[model samples]
Target: MHFLKAATIAILSPLVSATCTPWSTPGTCTATSSSCDFYTCLESKSGCGPTGYELGYALPFCNAITAVSSNLSVNGQAWYSATKLCLQNALSVEASCETSCTNIYLNAFASHVPCYLDSGFCELSGADLKVFFQVVGVAGVTSNDGLALFGAVLQGCVTKYQNGQVNMGWTKWLVRTLNGEI
Candidate 1:
């Protein structure tokens, strides 16, 4: 009986190991890139954008911004600084970093909506507004030609999060917002 039990354990070990694949970490920006382009990094399959299950780990927009800032050229650094400033100002206006704000900007670009001009949404004036537009233009968010490039993936994540199929940090916020609790 002991021998039979040992044989069964040995036989099942390899099968279990083979069947259970480990989770892979998402890719980040390359340190050797000539120029740091946020859109390219965000949209690339193996770049800063997290696909499927990886979305539960961190906010994709923030991740991409961090990755792109890792190794930036002089011009890239300038753009990064302006972008950070614009993002900070925007966040101060009740916009959430973990929510769909980033994607909304991208979507606005697709919908031909000048988000900066939306006083109710932007609320930025003068220099801040100018910088905001500059950053948005440089990030290529306004030049997408009406394509919701990341819409499908973002929608899938939202659906999965709403259904409790994923454990993202923003799930509670999303749920409350959807239920009109916020």
Candidate 2:
């Protein structure tokens, strides 16, 4: 009886104690203590999270998005390649349909829209893209619903330029806001 009980407990313990790999989007780690915090590995140099555990989109580490967009407008054009792509995409979509699409959904009526064709220019040059990156990338930092806030800021800047409202220092402000530098 003792031997049988021991074996049963041993088998069940592993099952009962199984911990979750990574945390959810809001970044909740709801696993037993046995499970490790995926970020810990980054410090310890153990290994990057296995598949679907790197961070965004819940894809596997191997397949996850390793790079994020670094769109910045400095002198009449995008400073980063990704920013240029964003500009192209925005222009393409705008030409097809004058409506803007947030990376995440928000109140459309309240959201601002750029009236002019140079919305992306305003966003890149005005906002501090680097700051925006830090704010969004920081773990456990809930500045303003993360993605939603970012989308709103982006929308606002884009709308301003589109509406021909570009002015002194507006581009700088937009870049800082978008990058989380501010």
Candidate 3:
């Protein structure tokens, strides 16, 4: 029933879709688009962006990470949460990380991601997001291990995406799976 509801909703709802799409105007795109654009750029490795548009993740390798980490806090948060969920579903077979802390982390992220202005800049900092991910794995010393694993998994996903192994998100996969369409 839950799957049905989600699938129905997904099928009926409008969706955001883009890859290597151009957003020539700075502040004109939503954070979701900004993040997607960023991801597309990163995934391209050698080159990206449309013919006439400036690339979103054009900074040098290290600076691109810094820009995504510090400048686009919501994108960072989204990356963290999305990576976590992907790991929980794909690799953490016997272990699940969806505790209250996870909800809190996601909620904290939600508050920070929605206010994209025309400048492609968000006012939030990555420090808060860093702190949020640190506490999500588990409680006590176990949490330290969980946090480390979580970080590794997130980085691995990023690496795989950059290497052209995976998509940046799993919502569509979830929807297809739930509807027995995967």
Q: Which prediction has more favorable TM-score, 2 or 3?
A: 2
Tens-place lDDT per residue, model 2, 1-182, is 22233334434544763333332223222221122232232212212234211222212211211233223234422333333233223222122222212211121111112221233434443345454344336541343343433454556665664566755466546656677989
1 against 3, candidate with superior lDDT: 1
lDDT digits (tens) for residues 1-182 of candidate 3: 22233234334433634233332333321123223343233224323334211232112322334344443356555554453333222211111212222222222222221221112112123464344434322351145433443343444444444555554354234334656997
Runs of candidate 3 exceeding 4 Å displacement: 1-72, 88-125, 137-144, 147-182
Clashes of 1: 0
Model 1, 1-182: lDDT tens digits are 22233334435634763222221334442322223342332334323244321232223443554554535444444544544334333322112212233332332222222111121112222343344334334444423321232232234445666666655344445556777999
Regions of candidate 1 where Cα sits further than 4 Å from its true position = 1-139, 142-147
Clashing pairs in 1: none
User: Which regions of candidate 2 deviate over 4 angstroms?
Assistant: 1-127, 138-144, 167-182
> Candidate 2, 92: how far from true, in Å?
42
**Per-candidate RMSD, Å:** 18.7, 20.9, 18.8
TM per model? 0.24, 0.22, 0.20
